[model samples]
Every structure is written in C-alpha cells, then in structure tokens.
Target: MDQSMASDLIGDLISCGNIDHAMVDGNKRPFICLELEDVSGNKLRNITLWSDYAQQLNDALGDRQNLGHVVIILQFMKHKIYKRKPAVSSMFGVTKLFINADIPDTHTFTKLLIENRGSEGDDHHVTHLTTFSSYSIKNDFLNNLQKVTINDIRDIVKPMSCVVVATVKKIEREADWWYLACVKCNHAAKQESVSEKDEYGVVVKKRSIFRCTNK
Candidate 1:
C-alpha cells in the first residue's frame, strides 16, 4: 500500500522520528534507524527501514534540510533491549512525503489550537495536539526560512528534549561552568556546565539546563 495514503491510520500523527544512524549494505542499498514513540508513554520504538524503501528514505533525508510533515506507517514486530532498556521494533517506513506541504499557512491549525486551549475533555489529546501544532509551526518557520542546520533540527525534535531559540545577550563563564542570560527574562539560573573530556575520547553530559525567557 502507498504509505502516504495510510497517513490517517497513523494515530495522533504529531511527530517524526529522528534518523540517528543510516547505513548501506554491501550491495549499495540503504537502511535507516529511527527513534519513534507514541502517545501512550509505553515505550520508544526503534524502526528499521529495509531495501529500496530504505534507499529512498536515505536520499529524502539527505542533509535533513526539509523539515516537512512526515507520515509513517509501521507494523510492530517485537521488543528487544538495547543498552538495558526496553524498545519496540518496527519495519516498513517512509519519509519526506510532504516536503512540499505548505506550513506557513498554518492559520487554521493555530486557530484550532487556540479554540482547544480551554478544552476540558482528554488532557492527553489537548497536550499532544497543542504540542504538535506548536512544533509544526516552528518546524515550518525554520525549514522554509532555511535558518537552522540539520543538527539544529535534530536537537529540536529529539524525544522528550526541550528546545528554545533566542538571542544570546550575555554569557558568564566560571572555572567549571558557564551561564547564559535570557534576553527577555534576565533569569540567572539558566546555567550550563562544561564536561571534561576523557582520554579515551568519551564525553558524558547531562540533560539540558532550564531557561525561562518569561516572554
């Protein structure tokens, strides 16, 4: 079946998986590794794209410049533990189906979000919908304007990762740490620490520090 046509089957289609590692086989064919999750909070899914579909996806994701809406149709296979964490395995993936989707004209979606802000029904629906809409607008703006690099896009969309874009007004560097000031809020606790690199070339880092612009 055409994956794009199955878009509606994908429930709560809000986010797209980030392509972390992609490899081509000895036959010069491509395969992709994607990190995906659903609204259930059950667990994150690791999807593998195989064969020709894989090659097509790899090319489509080249440079990752196009932050278009992705509609993926996947079938759950089994569960495996990698790094001692439970992960669902998936197959048959697609990407960049809507590279040409007009995102700037998101007024209707914005209106829907505003109308649902005070909704008292399912909180899960409300939260996911609002988040999806916000991210969609942000992605559209960033991609269409070509203001951010692929790494920036990955950072913004990574699972459970928070991203904020603002002008840096000031920086404070200490012996072991550094802090950034929020141009709008002037918050002081928005600090980040630098990690020491090990001799083996491994660097361990913590989650991103919180910063409130209060704008």
Candidate 2:
C-alpha cells in the first residue's frame, strides 16, 4: 500500500458487454466487461467495472453502443489480472472515472474518433455527463517507507520489513505445470491406472479415472 504515483489509463472504449453479476469476496456484485483500444498505440486491452461503478457506467451508457466516440480516463487506477487478461480498473474509495471531459487530450481524441467514424457521424454521443462525488486520493500521506531491492530480500534477515520498488524488465515463458485437482475437496487427484473390459467382455485396455473422496 506504499504506492503513491497513481497509474493513468486513457483509451477509447471499443466494446462493452451488459452489466453482469459476479461473486466477489463471497458477495454478489455487478460488473461489466469492457474492451478498450489505445488511440495512438493501437493496442487493445480489457477493463472491468465492478459494484456501484459498474451500475453507474451502464446507466450512463443507456442504449449507446459506439462508446468509441468517448474517451475514458481512469485516475488512480490499479492493475490486475482478471481471467488471465491484463486489466486496468478503478481502486475502491480512491479512483475516479472521467468521460468526455473538456481536457485537451479528450478534445483531440474526440476529433480523431469523429474522423474515424467517417460520414456516418456521431448519433450515439450521449449528452449526459457521468460523475461521482465520493472519490478521494489515498496517497495523500508523506511516503516514509524504506525502499529495498530484490537482492536485499535474502540479505535482510527476518523480523525486518521494507518495501521493494522494481520494474518488470521481462516476462519469460515458463513450462506448463498444472496438478490435477479433486472435484469435491480440490485436492490433488491421485494418478492410477485400472483395467476395463470392452463390449466383447475381453480385457480391452487400461483407463484413468479421477475419484473425489468427498463425493
């Protein structure tokens, strides 16, 4: 929680699914899956809105589909991996979303979007502005945490706590290793072979079976 500089995400909303319910922390909440494309870089990424923000965005959008006309600005955003996809989303009690604001970048983005839309023009530009007032910055405090290094993880003995700041330089592909898990208890499934008979009643071959003890 020592992070201070908030990550900023600016992109054009490409496609968004309908508001769906999900179980988060054992509580059912609302969310919407969104796909965004970076205008200048032309990169596609996924973004998900959860809880009240999901409802607010869905309500703001109404029946609009081409949200591409609007530029999305997520302030104080957090990075997460949802369903094995990289995502940028609002932080609870800290982040805020700004859509179609009067910012300079937004103006340029809207112009670009309009040009891309060609003669079709913009018929789905909802004039309704989206806003929320409960937003606040959490990193307003002075940073006093001691910074450490990856090498320090071993050098520093136990009972000592510090923060480590490092940039991910590379992500190497690793070998796939997935242990078979039980269906009922989710424990590792035991591997064994058992002989089975075919329709002819003769010993056909050996087969594998996954057994769940809890069931």
- For model 2, the run of ten residues with the poorest summed lDDT: 129-138
The TM-scores, one per candidate, come to 0.27, 0.49
Clashing residue pairs in candidate 1 (N, C-alpha, C atoms within 3 angstroms): none
Which regions of candidate 2 deviate over 4 angstroms? 1-6, 65-68, 112-215
Collision pairs in model 2 = none
Which candidate has the highest TM-score of all? 2
lDDT of each: 0.41, 0.64
Which candidate comes out best when scored by lDDT? 2
- Off-target runs (Cα >4 Å) in candidate 1 are 1-30, 37-45, 90-215
In angstroms, how far off is 176's CA in candidate 2? 38
